[model samples]
Target: MESITEEQLIQMVRDFIESESSAPQISVSSSESHIDSDHHHQPSNIDTLEEMIWRETTDVEVEILEKILMYMRNMGSLIIEPKNLKKWVVLRLKMDGYEASLCKTTWVSFPGRAKGNYEFVDVITNGTRVIIDMEFRSQFELARPTQSYTKLIEALPSFFIGTEEKLGNVVTLLCSAAKESLKESGLHIPPWRKATYMLPKWFSENCKKVSFSPNSNSTIEEF
Candidate 1:
């Protein structure tokens, strides 16, 4: 008898599944199907959460992903915790004339009993509790997982409706790499991408300029 290789084992599993319409009875899902008295006896927050959001992936990364919150620090506009958005910024270079997508995610958390998970992201973009809604659309662009960036125009939404009244105007900035970056050895961002700043905050006195680490409390994620 010959031993099966990794590829062969995978193929065998695929063939077995195709031969059988149903999967092995590992555990019943409380999500993808109707609840039965027998299988519904399980306990899991994420299980019920899946039904609440209607999606399998509602995860938000913290160690690095938490940086998305910094955008709120320098904004001059407001959305009053009821909106969500994600935008595409840059693209990774591809032969098909492709680029990685970039964007940000924001929302405020609602006051809830279960870990207070949902409310934080909602107040940020007005999403209901347990949901992580984003305001800037640029974070979703790149499927790659890198960590470095500098100099770009980003949006600043209001926490409360009509925040621009006190915030003045949103603005962009001329930038160097993140504070701990090595680009000083001659940083090379695209000519079209480098910028000084955008207004109405550009004309403000309090908005000071400073170099930040690529990962320094920014809206961009690991990739």
Candidate 2:
């Protein structure tokens, strides 16, 4: 990726902020409608996990998440592929003066895990790193999910923007719950769904950071 000049970055930020300011504010309760209609009947554990997710989110993360949501609402239709969408999001975050990058993580097969690679975005502010997964809830979907597990999945956000530690905690909690849910339904838990396997998709040491530039080709650096 080529580098964008400071002047260009400033102009982009100004335009984005102006457009965002004109848009109507979104209500927090509006998201509740996306949940399953049966959410009211969900078990206590699902409620606990939902509470934990929000409780761990910091103010900075929330602000960034709102920008992301707005961008998706206004400009997402123009982008068709997931990779391009992520790249655009990184550029937008940079315009907002956030240290954001597109990260690609690849892992080799281990004794009990399969080889796989994944891509997502991350932003650093005030010495804290936050992971952003646009496809967060789908990662936990099962072909034949138990009613309980389905309820749990419904409680998750379609996109996640939070600290790495909090994400890890969520993975652990969800994976454990998944195992139990599957067991209750006489189904076997897949290795890919285990916390040990899923965690590396974001935390792997083999991550490559791709920096965006508007004027030139993007550059990749191994982390």
Candidate 3:
């Protein structure tokens, strides 16, 4: 299969979100008084998206995932495992007494195209099934100093860094980690749509410097 371009990747994800959002919700009829004995909780939209995307595969997906894995290994302690066909644990970032589970999902296949199977990333936290929207693509800007941490910080409730000062520090650390990871992975992000962005207006005055080195500071535990 041909490699999927980054724009195609982003477009695929956007399309998937739009399609799922537009889908009509199924309602149960009152005539059916009893639910099935084996009925289970319905999966979230993200779960459905993941399942749908995982059905297709491509060389681009492999290349993208490999880059992410290389970058993750340099960041901190990680635990990698396979969950199943539609889902699996690629990396569990363990640091600051918290864990962020990163997985591959959202394989992009156009409505009628079969060769373009691009994948996207999702992060989950410990003891929870909710997918934290990092808004990575929304935050991507090639000209800025990557600021991909708002959703991540909000999602990581277990982490102690919450104050404006500490939060900015953590954000900076994350941005740096992302930069290093992408660099090491040799991923070519366009100049106009780089994975990083300038600090938001609010962060301009609140950012505080903190000592954080993914390679030197954090311990590594691979599984």
lDDT of 1 by residue, 1-223 (tens): 3432334323433432242233222355667467677666563332332222222212322211223333333222332212222221111111113221221222222232111111112111222112122322132112221243221111111111112212121111112222123244344433222222211111223332222233344432322
lDDT of 1 at 112: 24
Give lDDT tens digits, candidate 2, residues 28-110. 47666466766663436665675556654588887886786565555522423434657777887887788999999999998
Which is the winner by TM-score between candidate 1 and candidate 2? 2
lDDT by residue for model 3 (1-223), tens = 3432334333434443454355445555775556667875564433333333332323334333334334434433333322211122222222332233333222222333222111222222343222222233344222323233233322222211112333344345545544554565566543322212323322322322222233553332322
The lDDT per prediction is: 0.25, 0.72, 0.33
Sorting all predicted structures by TM-score, with the top scorer first, yields: 2, 3, 1
* Candidate 3: residue pairs that collide: 142-194, 146-196, 146-197
TM-score of each: 0.18, 0.74, 0.22
For TM-score, the strongest prediction is: 2
For model 1, what is the alpha-carbon lDDT of residue 94?
A: 16
Highest lDDT: which candidate? 2
- In model 1, which range of ten residues has the least summed lDDT? 113-122
The TM-score measured for candidate 1 stands at 0.18
